[model samples]
Target: MTSTFTVLPVPLDHLFSPGDDINSIVIEALSTTRWPDESTGISDGDIIVVTSKVVAKAEGRVVEAASRESVIDQQAERIVAVKHTPRGVTKIVQTSHGLVLAAAGVDASNTEQGTVVLLPVDSDASARQLRDHVIDRTGVAVGVIITDTMGRPWRLGVTDVAIGSSGVHVLDDYTGRHDDFGNTLEMTVVAIADEIASAVDLATGKL
Candidate 1:
């Protein structure tokens, strides 16, 4: 791992639509946009963090739904829990993609009226494809992480978490390593991908 890293948001002007090539779009943005330090172009170790919403949109995952609940029901593999709040009923479900998230990863925000966006069919595959595209275009090897917003089980507020990753080690396991104090460590694995996702979210803001 590097001692330091930089987070750069790829500025995009066009709204993503179904059937759009996300790899081309992202590469173009990175190629043309000037960085904060006046640098232009991707580096070898840069990790491209993309919001899953855009990936879903590009994959034609948007669906017209009379109610988001209906779509959630269709996407959910199993209902994990349900809660009745003052606002409405909230369902925590495991999606068909094996992700346990609220509303089965169905998003209704920042989309056309009467439509909601679904999570990518296979986020890991999506990440791999994007990583391949970046390498092919620039001859620079970089990691890719696809993220989605989710509320923690016992935590307040929502944050971005990695749903798919490629060209990156998602976990840093230190289960049998020793600490600085020479004490044997156990269960010290870190979710590096999720941490990167949250950090990128801070830089990019909401999609």
Candidate 2:
């Protein structure tokens, strides 16, 4: 059978507050949004890419808004690299999650006037909980990915990448696959989670 892929961006109508149940909010959003058809809601094999900001908020991973430098310092384990931009000095640091990212994944945007958001304490666990609760509520087997924005080492702009994933095959291994020329393929593993996260980022924007 032939196969096709689709990524649907679910928009949240309500401003999420700290300690909200993410699963309920997501299910509610799905309930309200008009899908392509009645049967076209979430289903098995569907991948839900949720921004980590919302997940963090729901988990109460936030603090009183502080200066960007201070927030970065608090979250970063060590500075990996730094660049002086016109706005200020930009630092790429290794976060507790072992991710080398800008500002150590501390975000001030889309947050309350006096608060900032942090990465979920354990993104993988967060993803698992979301996946389990969502499946329980809807009876639809779906994958969940918690994503965060990061700047590529050599890229100018930023893109969303998965920090936590659940019920999803994060990698596609094609090490033994054959090529059209009948040659054996090796060392070919695709990072499916990051790709999905990046694709959804285009729709979500930095806001």
Candidate 3:
């Protein structure tokens, strides 16, 4: 027997806008990727990881580009740190999502001119909604994960991390399990959602 892991990037042919139905858009995009054998389409237990940008756009979280700074300030709970570079000022702050990240996850890339994308108000809820909608449309019990890019404290570059998840176990607990050395694992756990997001990020490249 053999086990394999795969991540397929869904190619979206159209640009998403505010008020767009993400559930339908996602289903449509996936439909184009189906194999001749319907059984090989989205299956039970498969996870669909989507970038937070589309989710934000669908949720009408866009603001004028000139308001980027002000919007970031408002999204932040508290400023953790700040840096002034040639481009401009960069801020690391704690957001309403309890995520301490740069500019509070308010992004200004890959969007329309003079506009910026804000993080979804509730990522977990967003994931749950997406998961339910996908299941309803395709009858496939798939998990959904919404991801955002963040710079780690000790890392030089940014990487995608899970901000929302549904129908998937986010943690893999290894407590009470013995290792090869027979040492009992008392406090071992893995963040499954974040790991999946990171893997998908590597496969899909930057958002």
Candidate maximizing lDDT: 1
> Mind giving the per-residue lDDT tens digits that candidate 3 earns over 94-194?
99889998898888888998899999999999999999999988899999999999888876888788999999899999999998999999998988898
Q: For each candidate, what TM-score against the reference?
A: 0.94, 0.89, 0.92
Please say which candidate is ahead in TM-score: 1 or 3. 1
lDDT of 2 by residue, 1-207 (tens): 356665566787767777787788788777654455545567788888889888888888888875657878988999998999898788889988899987788888989888888898999999999889889888989899999988786678888889999998899898999988998888989898999999888866775
Best by TM-score: 1
- Global lDDT of each candidate: 0.89, 0.84, 0.89
Candidate 3 stretches with Cα past 4 Å from truth are: 34-39
In every candidate, how many clashes are there? 0, 0, 0
Q: Report the C-alpha lDDT of model 1 over 1-207, residue by residue, as the tens digit.
A: 358767877777778899998988998888875677888787878889999999999999999867678889988989999999999889999987889999898888977888999999999999999999899988999899999999997889988999999999999998999878999888899999999999989898875
Where is model 2 more than 4 Å wrong at Cα?
33-38
Candidate ordering by lDDT (highest first)? 1, 3, 2
